[model samples]
Target chain A: MTMKKRNLLLSIIAVIVLFGVANFVQLEMDAYIRRIVNLCMIYAIIGLSMNITNGFVGQFALGQAGFMAVGAYVVGIFTVPVAMRPGVFYATPMNPAIINIYMPLGVALIVGGLLAALIAFVIGTPVLRLRGDYLAIATLGFSEIIRIVITNASSITNGALGIKNIPPLNDVRIIFLATLITFILITLLINSSYGRAFKAIREDEIAAEAMGIDLFYHKNLAFMISAFFAGIGGGLYGALLGTVDPKNFLFTLTYNFLLIIVLGGMGSITGSMLGAVIVTAGLEYLRVFDEPLELFGMAIPLFRPGFRMVMFSVLLMFCVLFWRKGIMGTEEFTWDKFVNFCKHPLAYFTKKGAHAE
Target chain B: MEFFQAFANMTAASFAQHMANGISLGSLYAMIAIGYTMVYGILLMINFAHGDIVMMACYFAFFGITVFHIPWFMTFIGTIIATALLGVVIERAAYRPLRDAPKNSVLISAIGASFLLENLANYLFSGRPMRFPDIPLLSQNIAVGGGVQIQAICFVIPVITIISLVVLLHIVNHTKTGMAMRAVSKDYEIARVMGINIDNVISITFAIGSAMAAIGAIMWGIRYPGITPMLGVMPGLKCFVAAVVGGIGNIKGAVLGGFILGLGEILIVAFFPQLSGYRDAFAFIVLILILYYKPTGLLGETTTEKV
Candidate 1:
């Protein structure tokens, strides 16, 4: 069989297996473990969206949280039952226009993504003109502006009290399917001619422009698509948590996505997937550092709350300093490479070293 | 007419008080912006950790005074020294290794350094705000006639800011070390070939920048009377906006930008109290507008990109 055919078959089988496992886990596992798995998928979507802009396009935009906030609030507002709207908007009456409109979960998620894309399109017009650090800071500014706006628009966002009783999509299967679709769509885009244009721009904008690639169009396209997925992920997050607040979408939340991309390997979709799982699971595993411990019957004063995040940040610094290229670098998990690695793991290391030297 | 009426309703004393508050806040921003501009000038990269270094300075002084029972003068000296050392160490460890890396990688490293410092501070300080040790002379409220009450530090801050700016200007324009710094900033390769110790100059630049941050922290603590691990985040971002508004890489521009931001923030609240909730958004709006219309910023010279 051809390699493409084999890969196609493998992907199909993988999906089936994932669906089966999700079904079993949903039935067997406790709520906590199931929640973690769902979060891993949600984070995977977020990481992929970030990778599209930061990794593939080579734009250092740091406005993921802002876009996510747009998505979360949009989904939260539309999907919250109409009866609960008054209680959610207790600071003031629910904006009467939106009060009567109730959207299904799927439609709300899409509208959330589209709204985020709309905002990105508006901001990207002026912002994509900037290069390097200027672009980074500009995008960051927009994100902060979004949060501040959300805080003040109490009639809509409920003024920082946040909305509770969001209809929870607690099913693991739903998250798994959503993540799979997002991954496939992004992968296809990255492999298309437009994706090549993005890569060309990333490599050298002037040269790409000389080659007749429209820099503004391609950059904005990638940015909007990224925002769309980020919105979807944000909507899922709101649904998963059963709550949404402006505070939940703070600028610092963007750092989590940054760390994922940096660790998973920029420009590699598989790497982002791997990164999301490891980071999400690793964060949970590191909960021990935040908990007080007793060793030899003596309480450990140093191992207290807040220590986990400290260790996590140090790990991030070490990763940046040492493993700047990240786990997969730019390489994807092709079947051929996987087969070669399985045959001889040492050979992979030696080959990488040779290439470096 | 309504706007005029509202403006007229305010007494002269309240206006003066607002101006004093603006100047005080502006001077603090100016102090921090100097560090940002100098680092950007020399390195051509945002020193993301600069704000955290300021936070660390506050904590250092806090411990020195409260735990060690040291005098305020000694605490100030120690904070400056320690902060300077930290700046030097950060440059050596985090930045030096990535000197030859892509600009984005270096930026990510700088961000990582910032996160590490903030989280470390959070862990060590327990994520709580600490009462800044009161310096009686500086923290006291003084009546400056016409019923205008202002913190004594407000009077002291601008004086210190001006002196620092003058000294910094003289050093950069006149002194040998300053000349070396200017040359390095102009072209590191040419400076190196000219037998200048590039690393040493960079270290000195960081030390000076961090010392300014420490001084800013002291003034910030005096004015605000509270310090927290996250205190530096907002100021850091605003000062960076100031640095950009003043035309990044220009020291004088940073000062001007700082004053504009400080006064702009205060006046916005005074004139449009209803929109006061949008205060934090003001700096960002200014940033976007400036970048769109005049990317070079006020007083900044434009440079052509070379192929």
Candidate 2:
């Protein structure tokens, strides 16, 4: 058999095995484990989308939370049962226009993604002109503005009270499927000619412009795509949590995805996937920092409610300072590379050593 | 028609009161913006932790007055010194290593520093809002003519802002150290060739910027009357927008930008009370509009990108 066909077969088998394992975990695992797994998949999607703009397109836009807010709100409004609107919209009556329109989960999620992409398209037109830190601050501003608007638009968004009891899509199978589809789509795009254009822009904007690449169009395209996936992830997030609020989409929430990208290796899809799993599970594991601990028969005073975040922030600083390339460093996992590494571990180490030198 | 009629019927006393409030608020913004502009001018990067530094200064003063029983004046001076030292420390620890690294790496480090400082404060201080000890001279309400009432600190804030501006302007424009600073900002290698200590110049800039943040924080505490760990976030962002609007590298422009933002925020609520819920959105909207129309900002010089 050809190497290409064999690799494809191997990948398909690997995916099937993963799905089988997921089914087993769903049937056997407790609620907490299931929830964490779902979060990992959702965050993986978020990390990948973030990579599209921040990693590939070279724009340091920090508006993921805003896009996620759009997605979550859309999903919350549409997927919630018609009977629950009054209870959810307790402060202000449900807007008459959207009161009766209930959508299935699949349709609602897609609509949410589209709505977020539409918002990105409008905002990106003017904003993508900015370079570097200006772009970052502008995107951050838009995200904050989105949060404030959501807080005030009580009639439509149900304001600060938020929508509750969103029909949970907590099934492992559903999340795995959604994540797989998102992963494949993004990977396909990244390997295409458009992806090359994105990398070119990242390498040098001036040179890219000098060459025949349309900076505005390509940037807007990548931004809208990123927003779309972030929206999907947001929809999944709301469904998993079964609640949606303006507070849930604060600017700090974007920092979670930022940490994931930084830790996983920016510009690498497999890196994002690995980062999502580690970060999500690691955060859960790090809960010990927030709980009282006894060391050497004495209670440590530093272990408290807010200490986990302090450790997390310190880790992020060290990562940026020393390990800026992170785990993957723009390199991806491939069948051939895996095979080569397995065949000669010494060669792999030596190759890496040579590159470092 | 009703809105116009009410506007027309508005008393001069209330108008003057709002004006005073705007100026006082604007002066605070100017102080903070000066820090942002100065740092950006020298380093070509935003000091994301400048706001958090302001937050730390507030905490310093809080501990100084409440815990240590220091007098307000002494605390204020000590806070200034502490904040300046903190700025120098941040520059040396967080920023100095990445001086020649990629711009984005330095930015990420700055963000990391900001998060570290904020989270550290949250861990140490317990995230509770504390009442700022009111200074008798600053907190007392003074009535100006026609029943216009304003805080004495409101007047004091503008005077401080103006005096600081003049002093900063003189130091940047006239002194030997200022000459070295301008040289380093113009070209680091060239300044080093001319025997200027690049590190010292950068450290001095941070010291001045952080001192401004300390002053701004104190004024912010007096005006708002309550202090929290997160208090710096909003003003920090708003003053950043102010710096950008006034032309980031231009010292005088930062003051202008600050007044515009402060007065505009007050007038926005004054004109449309219903829109008060969207108050924080105003600064961002202004930033977007300014960046769109004139990316160099009002007083910023346009520089071309070299391939």
Candidate 3:
């Protein structure tokens, strides 16, 4: 077979095996492990969505949390059973228009994504015109504005109390499928002409404009698509957590994705997915550092309630300081490279070290 | 009718009190904003850790007064010095190494530094809200006139803010170090070519900015008296907004922007109490509007992008 055909065949077989394993884990594993798996997929989707804008487009927009809020609220509003709406919005009645409105999880997810995209389209017009730090701050401002609006609009969002009793989405199969589809679609886009334009814009705005690429259109397109996926991811998150609140979508939440992208290597698709798994799992694993520990009946005072976060922050700083390129550094995981590395791991390190030297 | 009714109910004393509150708060904002403006002027990068430096300063003051049993005035001075040193160390450790790195990398590093500072505070301070040591001299309520009770710090803050601003301006415009700073801000390469020490200027900038933050934090702690690990986040963001509003690289602009934000925040709530719930959104709305109308800021000079 040609290299392309062989790669395609391998991909299909790998995907099938992955699904089989996921199915086994979902069915047999306890709820705790299963929740982690679901979260990994949801976070993967969110990370990939962020990578589209921050990585691929090279726009440092800090509005993912805002867009995710829009999506989460939509899903929370629509996916809750009609019977539970009164209880959820007991503080103030749900807006009569959307009060009895209920949609299946799948439809609600799409609707949420579309609504977020529409909002992104509106917001991107003015916001995307900004450059660098200005854009980042503007997007961040918009995110806060979104949160504030959610807090005040009690009839719609149930105000600061937040919507609860969201139908729990524990099934790993659907979430996994959604994540797979998102990855494939984003990968395809990144390979297309539009994606090339985005890359060109990221590389140099003036040069790209000189090359006849429309900067505004392309940037906004990437932003809208990013918002769409972030919305879907947000919907999935609400489904998984069975809760949605304005506090949950604070701008600080954006930093989580920022960490993922930076650690995974910005602009790398598979890297983001890998990062999501590592960050989600690693954060949980790092809980050991938060708990008081004993060795031979001696208390270790260093392990405390907030030490885990302190360690996490230090890791981020260390990564930025020494390993700025992160794990993948704009390179994708190709089967050929993987096989080569497997065969001669020492050679890979030696070559890399030599190159650095 | 309600708006009219609210406006009608405002007495001269209440109005004066609000004005005093606005100016005091505005000056406090101006003090913190100067740090952001000065750093942005020198480095062309937002020192995201500046706010955390303020938080750290408050903690330093807290520890100095409570644990060390230091006198309040000495504690304030020590806190400023320590915070200034912390600023210099942060710059040397986190930012200096990334001098030639990509802008994104630098920004990420700055954010990392910020998160590190905040989380470290959380770790050390246990994320609990601590009572800021009361400086009774500052926090005491004084009846000035017409039954309007105002804290003594309100009178002291604006006076101190003006004094510092004048001192800062004098240093920037008249002193040799100030000339060096101006040159560095103008063009790093040209400044280096002119035999100015870039690293030293940057370090000095961070120190001054942080010292200002310490001053602001002291006053802020006295005024509000609630200290927490995340205390700086909102004020940090708002001061950044102020720095931008007045024209980021201009000191006076930051001061003006600070006043605008402070007064706007107070007056909006005073006149439209119903809109008080949307208070935090006020700064962002002003920011977006300013960015849309005058992208360079109110007093900022526009620069053409070179091909």
- Listed models, DockQ each: 0.79, 0.85, 0.76
Local distance difference test values of all predictions, in order: 0.91, 0.91, 0.92
How good is chain A of candidate 2, measured by TM-score?
0.98
Better of 2 and 3 by TM-score: 2
B-chain TM-score, candidate 3: 0.98
| Candidate 2 structure quality by residue, lDDT tens digits, B1-307 | 6567557867888888888889999999999999999999889998999999999999998899989999999999999999999999999999999988888888889888988898899989989889988888899999888877799999999999999999999999999999988888778788999899889999999999999999989888888978777788889889999999999988999999999999999877776778889989999999989999988889999988766
* Candidate 2 residue spans exceeding 4 A from truth: B1-6, B145-148
> Which of the CAPRI classes, incorrect, acceptable, medium or high, describes model 3?
medium
Which lDDT tens digits does candidate 3 get at residues B152-181? Answer: 999999999999999999999999999999
* Model 2, C-alpha of B185: deviation from truth (Å): 1.6
TM-score of predicted model 3? 0.98
Tell me the lDDT of model 3 at A144: 88
The CAPRI-style docking tier of model 2 reads: high
Colliding pairs, model 3 = none
Q: Return the lDDT, model 2, position A248.
A: 98
